[model samples]
Target: MSVALDGVGFVHANGHRALTGISLSAGAGERLAVIGPSGAGKTTLMRVLGAALHPVEGRVAVLDVDPWKLSPSALRKLRARIATVHQAPPIAPRLRVVTAVLSGRLGEWTLPRAIASLLHPSDIAGAHEALTRVSLQDRLFDRCDRLSGGQLQRVGVARAMYQRPALLLADEPVSALDPTLADATLRELVAQSEATGATFIASLHAVDLALHWFPRIVGMREGRVVFDRPRDEVTQEMLTALYANEHTAQGAADSAVPMHLAVCRA
Candidate 1:
């Protein structure tokens, strides 16, 4: 398995429980999308799978290594093989786009080389190649501060693609984009994973996008897995049940479509 979680659980420092009793596994080249209403532990689940947050209970293995069991340096090495595209890009405002994209290799480069790349990006061609996939090659030398929120999000995706990790986890990576750009960016991400044989997993708020893009759908609710099914098997009834909540029922109802039609259209 490229990514595995068994009985995983997490709680914030302030004592808010985020996830509980989650178990999942995905092999290389598999595409999975997680969908649910806001605050349904989707982000928490991504953090766990990305090895950014060690589970307080159970285990998480990425590319066959138990992340928490590794030493600090070893953990860094493991994380280099797992790329996480966050909702926020986390790039410095003043950094050049090329420099930001090139940072993807910092984990694999020597300390001196990494520092040098920050001062003068060595792999301009590689950075351009990555940005081209997202249709941002022209902005390669622009300051990150000059970009819009959605553009920054695309830069993040490009960086992850540049890293070429064995496992890719994205937490609402397209949340900042319009429908058109969002669809295009998702196509790029899914294509990259397939072409490289990497496992791709994303948590998205758009039910239609999730249903259309991924073959496997994992529905989450209240910090737990409501259903994990093949796309064809996911029905509107299942979606309604998965997203049913006092405040969000209407919103969920608006998003839910006939699963069979979604597949056909996709």
Candidate 2:
């Protein structure tokens, strides 16, 4: 298994249960889309799978190595094979786009080379190649701060590609983009992962996007796994029910009518 979670559970310092008894496994080159409401533990699960967090119960293994048992050096080596893109990516705004992309190579570069690259990016050709993959080669010299939100996200993807990781984890990577941009971003992401034969686990809020792009879907509610099935097996009715409860609460909080008018009309 490239990624595996066995009977995992997590409790935060605040005593909130973020994940409960989750077990999942993905082989190389598989794409798994995880979907849920806001508090459904999707992010927590992604953290656990990416080896960023240790579960309170059960175990996690990536490429046959126990994630929690690795020493600092070993852990660094393990992380080189896994990459994560969070909802709000942490790209340095002041850095040139190429420099930001080169940071991905730090995990594999020697100390001196890494330092040299930081001061003056050493692999312009490789960085440009990565940008080309995402159709951003022209922006290689631009400061990261100047790119639009969608372009920034593409830079994030380019960095991940530069890492050449065997496993990828993405959390709501396109949620903030407009519909057309979101679709295009996701298509590029999926295509790049496929070209590399890397396994992917992405947390998504858009059911339509998941169904259209991913073959496997995992639905989570609260802290539990509610369903794991092929996209063909997921019915619209199930998704409708899954989101209805959350939407109902939101609707009540932001009532359609103005409060004063509602009171007067009543």
lDDT of 1 by residue, 141-259 (tens): 99999999999999999999999988989999999999998999999998889889999999988877887788899999889999999888888788877777735543644565754
Model 2 lDDT tens row, 198-217? 99889988766676678788
lDDT of each: 0.89, 0.82
User: How far is 265's C-alpha from truth in model 2 (Å)?
Assistant: 49
Candidate 1, superposed: residue stretches over 4 Å from native? 246-256, 259-266
Each candidate's root-mean-square deviation in Å? Answer: 1.7, 8.1
The stretch of ten residues in a row with the least summed lDDT in candidate 2 is: 257-266
The weakest ten consecutive residues by lDDT in model 1 span 257-266
Q: Report lDDT (Cα) of residue 17, candidate 2.
A: 97
Give the best candidate by lDDT: 1
